[model samples]
Target: MLLLKFFGANVDWTSSIHPSAKIEYPWNLKIGPLSSLGEKSWIYAMAPITIGEKTCIGKEAYLITGSHNISSNNFELITRPINIGDCCWLTTGVTILPGVEIGNYSVIAANSTVTKSVDSWSVMGGNPAKFIKKREIKNA
Candidate 1:
C-alpha cells in the first residue's frame, strides 16, 4: 500500500487492495474509502480508473481503460476513464471496458462484460451487460 501511494495512486487509506491485484499506471488509479479490490483483480489504468467508497471489485475482475482503434492506420491506442460509483459491486470475472460509468448502488454480475454506462441502482448481467433489474435496498 505504501508502494502504491509512492507511485501516486490516490487510494484512500481505508481501502483494502489485495496483494495479488495487478495495477498498471498506478498514478491514474483512485480508490475511495472502504472499497475492496479482491485478489487477482487487474486494473489497466491507461487513462483513469476510479472506484468510489464502499465499492467491491471481486476477484479476477478486469477494469480496462484502453483499447486500440483498429480503423486507424497506425492502430492507434485509445484511452478513456472508467468510473464506478459509490456502494457498487462488480462481481468476479467482470470486465469493465473503457469510458464506462457505473452509477451508485449498481451491481454487475459475475463474468459480465460491461461496455456502456449503467444507471443508478441497476442490476446488470451477461456479455455486453444488459440491465437485468433495479436493485432495491429496503433500508437504503
Candidate 2:
C-alpha cells in the first residue's frame, strides 16, 4: 500500500492487503513480511498494532486497539497495543480486543474473541478463546 507507506506504516511489499480492508491510523500499524490481510478486515490502530512475519488474517476479522475508559465519567479514550507474532493465523470473523498479544505460531479459530494474551505455539478457540492445545510443528 503506497498510502500506508507514505504514512509510516511498516508494511512490506511481500504482504497482501485486501483493498476492502479498513485501516485506521495507518501510522501505528506495522505488518511484517509475508503477512496477508483478508477482505473487509479492520484494524483500529489508535495505538500500535504489530503483526509479525508470515501471518494471515481472515475475512472480516477485527483488531481493536482502543477502548472507552470505564472509570471516566466522560468515557475518555484508552489505547493499548496489539501484537500478533510471527506465523500466526487468525480465522474468519475473529475479534481481538485491546492489549491482546497472540504469540508466535498461534492459531485462532473462526469467530473467536480474544480477550487476553495467547501463549506461543497454541491453538485457541471458542467465544473467549480458550487455549485448546499446543501447536505441533514437524520438521520435514
Candidate 3:
C-alpha cells in the first residue's frame, strides 16, 4: 500500500497505489481504492481532485486543477475541482484541466488535453479532447 505523507489529505491504501507516484500541494486530493497511478505522474491539485476506484492513471500524465479566467477585468485566477470516475484509463501525457469530470470506464488517448467532461465508456483524444469513439466492455 502506498501512503501519501504530505498535504492535508488522507489516502486509504487498502487499494493499490504505486510507491513512486507524486502529488504536489495536495490540500484536498482524494483517491479511492484499487487505483494505480503510474510512474512519473504529476498531480497538481491547487483546488480539489478526486479519483475514483480502480482507475489507472498512465505514466507522465499531468493533472492541473488550476486555471485563470481571462475574461475577468483583472485577469483573475480561477480554480475548479476535478473528478475522475472509476475504471478509467488515462494514457501518457494526458492533461486534465480544472472543472473536468471524466465518467466511469472511459479511455483517454495519449497526449490528450481534457478541457471538459467526458461521457461514460467514451474514448477521447486530441487537443481539446473530443470523443473518438465509445467502448462497451463485458464484465470479467
TM of each candidate vs. truth: 0.98, 0.96, 0.87
Candidate 1 wrong stretches, greater than 4 Å: none
lDDT of 1 at 88: 99
lDDT of 1 at 57: 99
* Residue-level lDDT tens digits of model 3 in 60-85: 88888877778888888788888999
Candidate 2 or 1, higher TM-score = 1
lDDT of each: 0.98, 0.97, 0.84
Highest lDDT: give the candidate number. 1
How many clashing pairs does model 2 include?
0
User: lDDT-based ranking, best first?
Assistant: 1, 2, 3
Candidate 1, residue 15: how far the Cα is off, in Å: 0.4
Model 2, stretches more than 4 Å misplaced? none
* Clash totals in order: 0, 0, 0
lDDT of 2: 0.97
Candidate 2 lDDT over residue span 31-64, tens digit each: 9999999999999999999999999999999999
Whose TM-score is greatest here? 1
Minimal lDDT window, size 10, model 2 = 3-12
